[model samples]
Target: MARKRLLLAALAGVCVWGQAVPDSPGPAVGARVPGFDLADQTGQSRNLHSLFGPKGLMLVFFRSADW
Candidate 1:
């Protein structure tokens, strides 16, 4: 039982360490992002500035796909 508890504790520590932590207050409100590039669903390169229109752009982030 003690060995099982120790293993579980170690596993928990590993899981916590594997997670990501933000280093700074990334992109404050109303702050202009210095521009970035990412691939679209069609696998084409897209730029942040190009996406903005007269109405501007709305960025949405999903924490997990399981939800």
Candidate 2:
């Protein structure tokens, strides 16, 4: 029964994960990202401008199922 409940909970989570909230919709594709300054893992300050490439920067986000 515990295993079954976990499976159902996981399914319910997946069902709502892709529903986007209109007001808080994040940066759209092909849209320019606003300037931001943050510390990198190496403890150095970095901004979007510093990371620019010949084409452009592509940010990736990895969401763990455990969340």
Q: How many steric clashes between backbone atoms does each model show? A: 0, 0
Candidate 2: regions farther than 4 A off: 1-24, 63-67
- Model 1 regions lying over 4 Å from their true place: 1-25, 64-67
| lDDT (10s digit) by residue, model 1, range 6-53 | 668677766888655443336865787777899988999999987998
* Residues 1-67 of candidate 2: C-alpha lDDT, one tens digit per residue: 9767866766676677855435324775467767889887799999889988999777765576477
lDDT per model vs. reference: 0.75, 0.72
Q: How do the predictions measure up, each by TM-score?
A: 0.50, 0.50
RMSDs, each prediction?
A: 12.2, 10.8
Output the worst ten-in-a-row residue range by lDDT, candidate 2: 18-27
Determine the C-alpha RMSD for candidate 2 after optimal superposition of all C-alphas.
10.8
